[model samples]
Target: MASPESRIIELASRIAANTKKLNDYLVANNLPTPSFDVKGPKANLVPKQEIEVQAARAAIIDDTQELRRLVLGPREYLMSYTHNELISQQAITRFGIAHSFPVGSEASFAEIATKTGLPETNVRQVIRHAINKDIFVEPRPGVVAHNAVSRLLAEDKVIHDWVGASTDDLWQSASQTCNALTKYPGSQEPNETGFALANNTKATVYEVFSQFPERARRFGNAMRSFTEGTGFELSHVVDNFPWGDLPQDGVVVDIGGSQGFVCFALAAQFPSLSFIVQDLEPVIRAAEKQPQAIELGTDRIKFMTHDFLTEQLVHGADVYFFRWILHNWSDKYCVRILRNLIPALKQGAKIVINDNVLPKPGVMSKWQEDRLRSMDLTMTELQNSHERELEDWAELFKLADPRFEFQGGELPKSANLWVLVAEWKGE
Candidate 1:
């Protein structure tokens, strides 16, 4: 049997070959070709064609960098320990769907322009650019198509709810880093300065999402697709997590759980356990509209409107489940959020956090670490947050409630993305 490294090498070689073939096709078919010119100190005196070529090359590099950050970095981090079946599901989310269908397969650029009242040329150019990055596939010249991979983006109620929750919308704000620095010099450090510029007054997540509507849906859908098939992997691990040992039975408030996807999954798996999904009002509406989730039974699983940054409405839940929430805020803010839960928790209440923990050097694959680090940066840039280490999290827990100590035991494998658990103590 070929070693995994050998298989990866083969795959990389195949990807390179296919890239060359695609490039050749673009050249032969009169599509836009990649420019070769590289910018240099002496480029100011260069010819117009060379300058344009250099600019084009630079744009390609920037786009490649962003794509790598999103796909190879964060996506790979989630995929490393996630189930094998979710790869295609996540890949399809590269294209934002209007009604859960791949945007490319739904209609032509002309059709989109007509629907959105945008110019046809602009729409076509945008779609073409996205297609080049494999966000959408063009089966025939000027005619895009969809495959099984695109089905994850289709108009499913569950998919819609999931998409609304996990997407980021600060890419454009982050792009203005240089402009912000040049306009107003500040005493704040570089990272802090950037954070202030991106989101000082507007810490409200929903307001930020509203500002970047399209981007919010895009990021949310991408994450939702990523979690679809991997649900089983998490379910398998969480299902046996000593639920019976809990001191009391109260609501499992899925705090910040938009649309109740996690709650529904857990409730179905453990029928005896009741769940309450607490999120923003918009998300609660979306979750309520999720017919499939409703079929699971409203008695066992329900939705509640709650915001983490503000007051948490839940009280005395046996467990508070936070999946991929704290990573979006700075350590200080995370503590504030966690501290807010203290008043609502009963004695021995458990706090289960599901997020990617960065693996140390030589502990896991380099590719996986690289992905986590990139997400660390992305989260930092967009959300003014950092991915916390175990120690950092322990500190947060202590800050939240001195009475509760971290349950020091055998740590979950670093490979598992959703693999961190902490517990509360009674005085």
Candidate 2:
């Protein structure tokens, strides 16, 4: 086995080579080099579907994370990191610091303080801390300006909402998570969450949001930002699945499908496939009003109020699809949801799920794995639920019913979500 120092050297070489490859790809494609300048690339310019670009990006992420781990060593890394960075981020978002500075324009600390209603001294300290994190930049001494990251927070409402929701809602819940855990050890109830504790309410996160319209809107927009992200695009689902193989005018029931976004994408590609987007009454009403859904023709794609927790209402659909839904519920609840569909499923009917599948220990890149692990914890915090491993998912099907064949899962290239399918084998 190679020494730790030798391993570090190898990782560094890999990082350098991959960085060069990514840079060369960008340059060849006439894209701007990665920079924090306000005028830098508006978005990730590299198409995720490009195989070479994806490989280079993955290499950079894996090697850089490994190199950092090796350099920091185990003990120093574990002990040196602090939640102070999260606090700094919370302060920045809470105070509207990003919104205080105009894009491409610089502002003094005093000016920012006046705009944000924070003390000038506090603004300087907090913003200086944020500057170190590459959120904002102090271009000249005492003058702060929008970097590319900060500019997005100012200009993009969805991204701004994401930051706001993360700092204000998620951070508070995370702070109280330990207390909740201590109070109700091994609890599976959603109302037993830190979110409930933080808000001084026994309601689940969703129930609490239902009472606060503004908070709910911001949370929705925040989720929209995730779906609009590079790998989370609905096009990935449209392209990867063998939807074309289905018979003409086949029915696809989208359980818990919000706003029929995925259905719209599917309708555009597979014109012959019809859809039933089912959700709660409020969600169904809103989904019906979506211009994209209307434009795609309601005749072909219809919205219906149907709760998945109860019995599945629409029977014999070619596919019963669940996108980013099951992870919000505990295994017990997920099994219930699956069992509810049995009465409705025809023999050979498909159940398609698009959601995260946790990697086995030490298998994924540290950078990517950190995100998945965080999501797992987030599920616990919000709903006493979790992201599942592949085995866990297969077991879920088996637990639901023996007749349900766990056809397994596929992680589509350039997509963050896994596509898992099962078929109803029947008695």
Candidate 3:
């Protein structure tokens, strides 16, 4: 076996090799080199179908993370890595520094301060910190301009909302998580979460957000950004699943499908299939107002207000789809959601779940695993819920009712979310 130093050197070599591969792919494809400059390529989004590019990118990410860990060593990393970066990011976002800067044109620190009503000294400090993270750039002595990352924050409303929700809402909730755990030990109630504690509200995050529509909208937009990002494309669901196998004019009920986005994608592909998108009254109403919803045709796709926890009213549907829903609730509520569906699930009806499935220890790349684990903790903080492992998902169906055939799951290639299916064998 090689020594740790030797292993690190090997990783460094791999990193360089992969980096060159990625660079070559980009150049050969006439893709612009990755840069923080505002004028850099707009196609910065993850390569969807480019197999070689994807492999190179993945190798680079994995090797780079390992190399950094080896260089820092365990002790040094733990001591040096602090929450200061998060705090600095929060300050920049809260002060609207990214929004203040022009995309192509540079602005002096003083001008940014004036636009954002932040102190010039403070603006310089926060902006410089963000610059260190390659978010914004200082073109000259004290002038600031939008980098590509900062330009996205400035121009993309959904990305802006993502930052706002992450730094403001999620950060506050995370800060109070420990206190919440101490206060409400073993609590499973969503209302007893860190979010509730941070806001000093008895209501759950959703309930509180309901009272503050703008905040709710921002959070929704943040989720939209997340779903649209990288491997979370709706096309993955349309292509990876057996939607084409369903009978003509078969009903697909979308439980908690906020804007019928998934349905919209499915409808476009499986033209013979119809859909019922069920959500809260306001969400359903909002879905109805969308031009895409109208174009899909009301007869083909209908939006209805229905609380999923109570009972699923649409009976004998070919498939009941839950996308990014069950993970928000603890196992108890997840079971309840399943049990509620039983009344409507006809024999052999499919219960399809599209969500994160936590990987076993050391199975995934460190960077990818870290994100999944963070999401698991986030579920805990927000709703006392957690991301389930494959076994946990299987067990959930078993616990819901034995009559339900708990089919195994698959993580589709090029998809962020796992697609788990269970068939109902009516009792």
Candidate 4:
């Protein structure tokens, strides 16, 4: 019998096959091949509906990553693990380095330094570090030019906001997480988190950002960018849920719904369903003034200002929905928020949650799984909160009230978050 192929060779073969498949699809459709160059496509070229193509792409990603680690071997791979991966990107975002020069124009280190108010050597160091990450390019000695990534940073305000908020706020908080744990071991209070320690404030992350309007706006804008991502699109929630099964006049109360994006998406999909979007006074006031993504028919959707941490004010709504809200709070707070709805709920009332659900280890590609798990830790760093397993989610409702019947959850196909449901049995 022939000897079995080595793992490296197997990976290489798989990568080659997938690359050819993706390339053929792109070429057949006259789409531009993937590139890091200045003129690469802004959005992912592969349509989400192209399931086989997406699988091929994912296979390539997983194989290449595994092959890379295999090539590096164990000790070298361990040594290659980086802690300051975001430092260069953070410096670039903080200094507005990408905006210092216009896209399609090359600038020398000194020119960039002058524009950014940094020393020439400092500019060179930052840009050179970023270049290695494909954010920019040095075509020739001392000449810096835009790549697709850096150009996107220049052109997209929301993308810039993501990098800025990520590096400045999230990164700083993550660095202090160990210290927070050391100081307040096993604390579940949001204000006792690394965010508070890093910012030197007793307030939660939300409260800290609320104190700085521009900072809050930037953080909000960053979250907005996430909704535009393939995994977090509001369409995922609208398309896969059982909203059509409700009564013709079924009501949905969006707890802590910021700007009503989820409601807007759902309303467009299920016209018969009415929505009440509840948030803080400032958020509701701002959302009320702004035009919605979809036109709301008369009385189809209402905006109300109410903190979710307090009692739920909407009585007898069919579905009390939370999209990406509960993960920010500890179990104690989450249970409190759930119990707050008890007074308003009727028999067979549903509580719908749209949030990240931690998966079984090794069930997904390491590349993908690592990102999700990092987010779980990110919750800890920022708010002393966390992503939940399916059981953990069920446990919350049980802890809140025995009448809450956990109806279980299912992650939508190709979507990063899961939609979970519980029905309230009347007392």
Candidate 5:
């Protein structure tokens, strides 16, 4: 039999190899690749980046083989549940293994175990493991407590399923111990089901949003924060665009325009243009009650209850606007949604999709790219949709409507999100 150290090294080597193979496959398929840059930019090659990459490679390969062993080899399924076990431990560290009280603070294992209804040994083990990962901390030996990262979960209100949750929150989208490719057993083209499993209802995402009402409200609240911090930059940056070139009054419509936030922002900048906001009934109801929105009166701004998938109600609008919406559906469904808008577009209508388009291969930093891809998986596992790269978006448009041609442009200077403007030119 192999020595223990030899086994460990072998496992790491396998992981590294697996990561590389999958990473290579993804690259070949024109998909996103997780960054494992072991070397920084160097002519002769650097050691640090190489080391990290090697480690990542080893982990991926070993994890994959271990997972295979659990499923296909003689190993019992007991260890197959490791990811789920980690998820449970993670939840305890965030939601309270002992009590829902502050984690990582000066709390004894006995007290925490009693509060959480977990075994004392299990509680101790979870806390100890969490501490090592910095999920929580030990102010002193045996005294564990939550830290700031853990505190994100310690909130009374569940803003998003991820609120106050540990890093395992990422796993809530799917409980699979192995990657989705291995879990679903060969159904791997990337669609809404996978996206939803990874995001919308991920235990962490659920922890953040809770239920539908709360989810909608928190979604708006999150966006509100994003707008406040980045709105000025976007407004100023987008304002420089040729709004004058867009259609006149009755030409542009904002789909899913909750509370007229985007319209309000745009109206302030372009006083001459008319705007229409279409959304769900509840959102429209809420928008009607906002003091400023109600105060704005209802002239050019008309609120209507329309579902984008059912039909395109806003006909002949010179432009259709969808902001941060498409990343929530499968490619097929997204194509369906885009096709639904076809009839509403006249000869020259433009569709502006203001959402984060995953960057082209190697264009973005690995961290950002991985973050987005992880989000894509999260969405697949949760709400059943995902963010797509520019090529994905363009191809989707072409698939849905051959008459429509996509044009990519540099988003306004302050815009963190990218834009893919689809123009319907085949009158």
Candidate 6:
């Protein structure tokens, strides 16, 4: 009998096939090919709406990763261990090396050192290390220029904030997570987290950020950066949910909605539905000045200064919405957040959530799974919270209140966040 095909060969074969398919699609659509050059596209040109083309691109990534792993073998893979991977990136963001020179111009190590106030030798070492990761390109023996990645660091404020937050906040917290866990075993308080430990404080990350506006803005923009990618698009929420089914005068109270970005999108799509966006005073103040909020505030969307953890104030709304919010809190706090809404919830009112839903293991590609799993760990590291499966969402509502009739949810195709709705069955 013929032996089963080897794993590496199978992966390589799949990689080649998918690569051809993706390339064909790109060429057919007049889309540019992927590149690390400064002029290259910042994102995959294959649109998420094109399922076949996007799947081909995704398969190529998964197969290539698997092929590399198989070729590495177990011992060699074990040899790849290290914890200092974020060091150069940390230096880059902390020192603002990406901004030390013009994107289109080349800079020598000494020149960058002069601009960023770093020792020339250290700048040379850090940038050379970053070069290996494609952050910048060394065009000559002593001079460097921007690649697409480093160009982004210099030009995209949100992306820069994301990198800075990931390096300065998340990486430090990650290193201390195990130590924090060991010290405070089974702790669920947000203050009892790696973030708290890293900051050498008992306060939670949010509490710490509240004391520093610039840092908080960076963190906020870091979160906002994800919305630019696939699945985080507001269009997914607008298109997937049945907002059209609401009564002509239906109201959606967006609990903890910062900047009302989601409500702005929803208000545009469903003119029949009005919105009340509630957040803390600072967030409300910021949202009130945003162009979208200014435009939408005319008749449909109203902004309110409130906090989700406090008693919910807006009463008898048709729908209450939470997007990218609940997963940041531990189950204890999530239950409380839901309970706070009970006083405001009308009979037959709906609590609709747009958030991450952990998939069953092996349900997604490794690339996708790694991202979700890392996010799960991050929630734990920062807030003692965790991503939930569909079952967990059902159980969470039931635990919150018996009247919160737990309804099953759906993850829209190619979208990262799921849409779950639970109806209040109050008599």
Q: Candidate 1 clash total?
A: 5
The lDDT per prediction is: 0.58, 0.87, 0.87, 0.89, 0.61, 0.88
Cand. 2 Cα-lDDT: 0.87
Candidate 1 residue pairs that clash: 100-153, 100-154, 100-155, 163-220, 167-220
Tens-place lDDT digits, model 5, residues 237-296: 346446677755645688887777777767666666777888888779788677656655
Among all candidates shown, the one with the greatest lDDT: 4
TM-score of every candidate relative to the true structure = 0.57, 0.92, 0.92, 0.93, 0.65, 0.93
Cα lDDT of candidate 4 equals 0.89
Poorest 10 consecutive residues by lDDT, candidate 1: 36-45
Which window of 10 residues has the lowest lDDT sum in candidate 2?
Answer: 80-89
lDDT of 3: 0.87
lDDT of 4 by residue, 1-427 (tens): 3233388888899999999999999999999999988999876799987999988998898899888888898899998878868988998988889999999999999999999998999899889989988899999999999999999999999999999999999888998999999999999999998899999989998889878999999998997787667888787888878899999999999998988888988888898999999998988888876567335843888999898888888998899999889998999999999999999999999999999999899898677788889999999999999999999999999999999999998899878889999999975
Candidate 2 residue runs with Cα over 4 Å from true position: 244-249, 291-299
**Candidate numbers sorted by TM-score from highest down:** 4, 6, 3, 2, 5, 1
TM-score of 4: 0.93
Q: Across residues 156-273, which tens digit of lDDT does each residue of candidate 1 receive?
A: 5455345333222334344444455565443223344343465654244445557777756755665656655433245643653566565444568888887777777676566677
The segments of candidate 5 whose C-alpha lies over 4 angstroms from its true place after superposition are 1-89, 97-105, 155-170, 176-237, 247-250, 383-386
Residue runs of model 4 more than 4 Å from their true location after superposition: 1-5, 268-272, 291-298
How do the residues 1-427 of candidate 3 rate in per-residue lDDT, one tens digit apiece?
9898699889988888888888887788788888877887655534768877777787788888777878888898788677876766777667777778567888998898899998999888888888888878877899888888888877877777888899889988998999999999998899998999999998998889989998898998897777778889887788778998998889999999999989998988888999999999988888898999888778889999999889889989999999999999998999999999988878999999999999998887677788999999999989999999999999999999998898877888878899899999994
lDDT rank order:
4, 6, 2, 3, 5, 1
